[model samples]
Target: MKDYYEGESAVFPLFLVTSSDGAAWSRAMAWLFPTLLLQALLIVSFLHLIWDWFQKQSFNKQMFVLVWMRTVLGGLAAISPSVGSLEGMVFMISEVTLSIHMYVLFEIFLQSIVQAGIFLWLAKRFLILQRK
Candidate 1:
């Protein structure tokens, strides 16, 4: 079986972003068709998930939490461009994915946290009413 990276690499622009220097960003952008396509799919999926959750559809909270956590960790891992000996290509791949993930994860987690807080507040009110 192909590695996940390999599966994505053939079509994704990760190679272009990571392997090129200053003169290559434009050319790399041209080669980034797969990456852009996947990003579109991601946006659709995220919209569906949010819509489904809001509609009271059954969904796992843990999945959102896990994605959120991974995003945060990945963002941190991409922070330092100067610290590692990794190839420029690999670093670029990490940095871009991390940045995208961080943004998506934060948005999802913000909604989740707000929902949880409201639920807790209601539960506390219910308990106080029962004690009267």
Candidate 2:
């Protein structure tokens, strides 16, 4: 069996599982499904928030809703994967796999935090303008 990281050099990072075996591919998909689902949900929620804003909803309300949704969904996505196994099935259980999962979780969490901060700042500015 060809190792997923076969023929890789120090100059390049292994970003994907290159193995051709069915088990490897299945394992990759199992790990990827939830992440993709959460991302799709986040995008849909964002679009809905934009629609609400265009509909003349209160800016503060919209900001709060967006931030809340992002926080909840982002946290769920971050903790959804087991890293070592899924439903008693082990897939690509290796250090590289673990590293990839950690990287993706961290990225999701960081993006959520940044977006929430930006939304809060915008809400504060809107309130100030409304007061004036």
Per-model C-alpha lDDT, please? Answer: 0.45, 0.53
Model 1: lDDT equals 0.45
What is the TM-score (0 to 1) of candidate 2? 0.37
Q: Per-prediction TM-score, please?
A: 0.28, 0.37
Weakest ten-residue segment in model 1 by summed lDDT: 80-89
lDDT of 1 by residue, 1-132 (tens): 123224444323443243334557677677689885775466446545765454352234533443443344323333543112122225545544544444444554565456444544554587699999
Off by over 4 Å in 2: 1-68, 78-96
lDDT tens digits, residues 1-132, model 2?
133345543111243454544687688788797986787667666766676463365655655555555544544333343322231123333444555444544555566667756756765698699999
